[model samples]
Target: MLDINNALEDKLLGFIGAGNMAEAMIRGIIRNQVVQPDQIIASDISVERKEHLSSAFDIRIATDNHSLIDQSSVIFLAVKPQAVPAVLKDISANTGAEKLLISIAAGVPVKTLAAGLPKGPRIVRTMPNTPATVMEGAMAIASDSPARPEDLETVETLFRPIGRTVRIEEKLIDAVTGLSGSGPAYVFMILEALADGGVKMGLPRDVAETLAAQTLMGSAKLFLETRTNPGQLKCMVTSPGGTTISGIHELEKGGLRASLMNAVEAATIRSIELGKA
Candidate 1:
């Protein structure tokens, strides 16, 4: 369990959107005992969403953004990128220097977020992936100049239980979005392809999928635990004149490496374009 600092313990955490990512964070925080469920509050435009989240997480549901910001200290700006400007404007009057705003809206910058509100509220921007719903996400955090070190630390503490967290420059957040934010879909595609190969070789669909998923999960665990070069690890698995070598040869011939690189690059470029829009 994470030891949430006293600064956070005494304060209420609020979520501006009761979406998947916000729910994921709420689940992790409560499951990890970072804070009591009662100390959390969420506000959403949909009454059904508010009631559902409140019931599911046993947390409070605020009637509106203004009330939520007024009652909480740490606020998660979890609304969609397109919705951020209006949300900031809606809650701006209630936001103050003492409150901390942590945003997970992809392609939205701290500068843009700050511009929508009063000048003094601290802002921390993040890019987090869908895997966060399962508590195994990769997150990149960056903060505006006004945000203090402890504010950054608070954000890290809130996220640590859900997955790995990396502090990065705001400029690189778009790259992080392409790599990790959109990475789960790429990995899912690869997993599906691997399972399809097994099914083509006569394995049952369910068994093949399970094996493929376990193989991917185990490989990731091994890589993380050993911290060995991936190339070295690949060499370890590919013995002279072995089946693994044959498979690797086919992958290389198929330009698998180049395809993945191009995917990331393309996604990164798109992210930049979206931010501009």
Candidate 2:
């Protein structure tokens, strides 16, 4: 394992794209003081966005991607998949083997990144969810052959402050994308339905929303803290011939469980297809 202490103190961190996801990571780093605000650098095509980042985080902004790479030791390739090739081509010549490159772009494989950068640049690929905005995300990371154990540790430490992280093989990244990457939307839909049900039961809008959200949050906490299978937990909550059982029967009749399973399968397959494209 990479020492968490060493990673947290990295002096120079660069973000190649300053979009929403990158912004969230930057914000989390700043909020946690993982590194000083002055230690960070970001780049984007839009002057306005760059200015926003500079002002918000008190970090340097590169008008172009190469300048960002030039100033930092650790680089985050936060650009869209379509933009990765061009950006990498522009910076490959300048990047040395010592720099650690972490990419958040979906479906862009390690081989693709290695082909784009100079030979032997340490590379780490990660899948992070939208909930990263609140520092409650679930992230998964995989490293290329050249990446050292220290490099993997560094990447994990950087993400740990933001949320939970798991290390897995590069091949499993698509499944991580399907589960955590797209899972938040499914949870949101469930919360909305729960709120609607509350409203139908004559609760006020705000009350219904709070109740629904708290229910979800509490259930999540129970599963995490107790480390119990969800089925076991659900059984514990469900008394014989009770309201919970009645609601579960309604959900089963609606094929909710099967639908969710199919949803995850579809997402996993689509993620693979997107990578191929």
Candidate 3:
């Protein structure tokens, strides 16, 4: 793990694309009080996007790629996978040793991003989920060959405010994409199902949703605070011939565990496919 003690205040952080993920990160950084808005800048091809980001985040907006690259030491490649090549080409002329690049573009490898530049910027590829919008996300970070120890630390420092972060080997970034990247949707499905079960048991719609959400939240908190493995926690809750045990039996019968594993596997394969593309 990289050091979290390093401050992100030393350099300007720029977003090359003003999109949802970019907005989530900006919201997270600002909400965590990492730096003043003036220290951040973003550029987008869309006039509407530029306006929205500038107005919502109160950060400077650059009219062109070159201008943003000129001003930033740490730049985020937050554009779509298809858009990456063009943007990389556009910024190549100005990229330099002083810059560290962080990319959140899904399925676009670090090699692909670095390929467009002659001498590439130290590159870090990241996988962050939608929960980052609320600053409660999970993220995985990986770096290219040119990246240094300090570069990894800088990447971690940039994302630490967003949510929980982990550094993984570049090869497993696809696995991270499968587990945490697509995992939020799986979690949401679980939440919805739990809520539905509550409603089936006679709770009102709103009350059922609240109870389900709180249950998951409280359980997660307990797991984190007590540093207990989930199996241990589950065993602690499950009783001899009790309702919880019955529910677990039903879940097992339905192959919930295998289904989730398969879901992650399928998603990982898809990520690999995208990377190959």
Candidate 4:
């Protein structure tokens, strides 16, 4: 667990949708003792999902969204982005000022969420990457004015066990979505390319993949542990006229850095467009 302190205290945690991300959070929170299984409640439209969550985690299941909102102190708006409006409309009357809502729906702005609910609803918006399922995610959190400092801290506690969390302005959320939210796919593609390179050098397919993945993992670990500038680390690896420099030359020729920057920029623009929609 990245954060060991239990922040839920006596507050009951609820999930409006019991999907993969919600299940991952449930698994992580239970595994880390962030909250007792009984301290949680989740509701899903699917009966099979409700049964699976109950049997898998031994937590109480809400009969519907309204019941979940009525029972839970802190609620996670974990439904699909397109379903958020309907869910909000259904629960608006039941959700009062006392309740704090944290949303994980991508590209849904805090203003949009607030517009769907009653006046001055306490809301926090967050973007967490797919790696959260494995407890290795990077997440960014932003809160509206109605959300107190304690609310933000409580939100942090719920997410910390699942991965690392950072506080950011809501305006920067599109950039975060472009970067970390979509980052794993980019990394996976790089890994595949690296494995292909190794295969081109006559290595077995499995061995190539293993070596490529380990290299990427170790490089990331080294950078994080040392906190060294990546360029300095790259320079350290590239002795003059060496094999690494030779590879670097090819990467530069292929415009790798520019391509990655363009990818992030494009994604960010698309996120902004989606938010407007």
Candidate 5:
């Protein structure tokens, strides 16, 4: 393991972008006290964004990307997929084999990242979701062949404060992107639909929204705390001749379950296609 406690003490963390996902991780790290503000640095093209980050987090913000890479031991490539190639090319000369690089850009593969960097540099590719904004994300990571065990641990520690993380083969990352990366939006849509149903039943909008959100949170917590299968949990809430069962039947009749399954499948396929693109 990288010894997260030790890594944060001696290492400078760098981010190549100051966008929402990057900003969320920065906030999470500081809020959790995993890294002191001084230990983290960021660079972005926008002067306003740089100033905003500086004011918001009290961390060093560089106007140029090279300066950020030059000063840090661990660098996070948090830029969008389209921006990655140019950013990587810009930093390739500055990043040596010793530095650990973590990338959260979706649809960009580890091998692609490695090819863009100096040979033998440690690279960790991760897929993190929008829920990271709320510190409740699901993330998956995969390390390049040259990545050391400690390097992988350092990456895991960085994300731990944000949400649950898992290590998987790089090949599985696209599936992770489909299931969790885009999954939050799916859940949000469901929550909206549930709230709409509540409103249709004469419940006030605010109360219905609150109940829907809480119900989702509570059900998720139950699954986590009890470590029970979702099917079993659903059964527990459902009575043979009651409202829960009645609602479930309506959902089934509406092809909700099948639609969800197809939706996830479509997302997975689309992710693969995007990566190939």
Candidate 6:
């Protein structure tokens, strides 16, 4: 908690693109009371979406990027990667030393953003997952050369209320994009598999789904809170020839661990390729 109240005083938090991720961050900020809803502003190409944002969150909305930029000190680059170049160009003239530019676009490198202008704003790039919608996101942040320590702190303060934030080198962002960025889908698949197993074992579909989700959530929370080694936790559940051990044996035989590693590696390589393009 880096005193966001004082740090964000008189500064309007703005989003350049109003999409799901932008809405999530806005909800998190308002839910946590980091700043009042009135202090937030967002711009979108669609007037309907902007109106929805204003009506849903009680925040200000601008119809164009420049109008939003003129009113904001901390700006979230929430547009798609394909749209970044043009959007950055559109806003570059107005961006400067005083504004903190944070991008959540996937696979767009910090260098690309810095080169958006001859002298860029203090830029910070981030890879944030969809769990941010629930205020439980895992976000990895990296900064360009022009970004100072305070700039990173500004990003942390902005995101801390939403979920966990970590500082990492720019080079690792693609890998992060592979892991946490794409990881929720992997977990969703696992959750589906678990629910299917429960269904096959005679549980109703809805009950199985709840059990599958809650079990994973509880297990993750317990591991994080206790800082317990996963292997040890597995052993704790496994008795000599117990049902848990039998299930574990089946999972190991099915090569679950290797499959997950391969999935992450494949996704990471794809992310790198996207960055290169």
Better by TM-score, candidate 3 or 1: 1
List model 3 lDDT by residue over 1-277, tens digit each.
Answer: 4433343335568999998889988999888877678888999999899899888889999989889988888888998778888898899999977788888877877788778876668788899987888878899988543688888787777678888998887888889999998898998899999999989999998998998889987998898889998999999989998989999999999999999999999999988888777
lDDT of 5 by residue, 10-69 (tens): 667999999988888888888887788988899998888888888999999876888888
lDDT values for all models: 0.87, 0.84, 0.85, 0.85, 0.84, 0.86
| Each prediction's RMSD to truth | 1.8, 2.0, 2.4, 2.6, 1.8, 1.6
**lDDT for model 2:** 0.84
lDDT of 1 by residue, 85-190 (tens): 8898898887888888998988887878788877468889988877776779899998543598888888888888789999988999989988998899999999
- Pairs with steric clashes in candidate 2: none
Model 4 gets an lDDT of 0.85
Against the hidden true structure, what lDDT does model 5 obtain?
0.84
By summed lDDT, the worst window of 10 consecutive residues in model 1 runs over 1-10
lDDT string, candidate 2, 154-272, tens digits: 88778988889988889998888878888999999999999999999999989999999999999999999999999999999899999999999999999999999888888888878
**Higher-scoring candidate on TM-score, 1 or 5:** 1
Which runs in model 2 stand beyond 4 Å of their true positions?
Answer: 1-11, 143-145
Tens-digit lDDT string for candidate 6 (1-277) = 5776565568788898888889988988899887899999999887887998999999999768988888888889998777888788888888887788888988888788888855568888898887887889999997543587887887888788788888888888888888998999999999999999999999999999999999999999999899999999989999997889899989999999999999888888887787667
- Report lDDT (Cα) of residue 196, candidate 4: 99
For residue 181, model 4's alpha carbon misses the true position, in angstroms, by 1.0
Worst 10 residues of 3 by lDDT: 1-10
Clash pairs, model 4 backbone: none
Residue 70 CA error for candidate 5 (Å)? 0.4
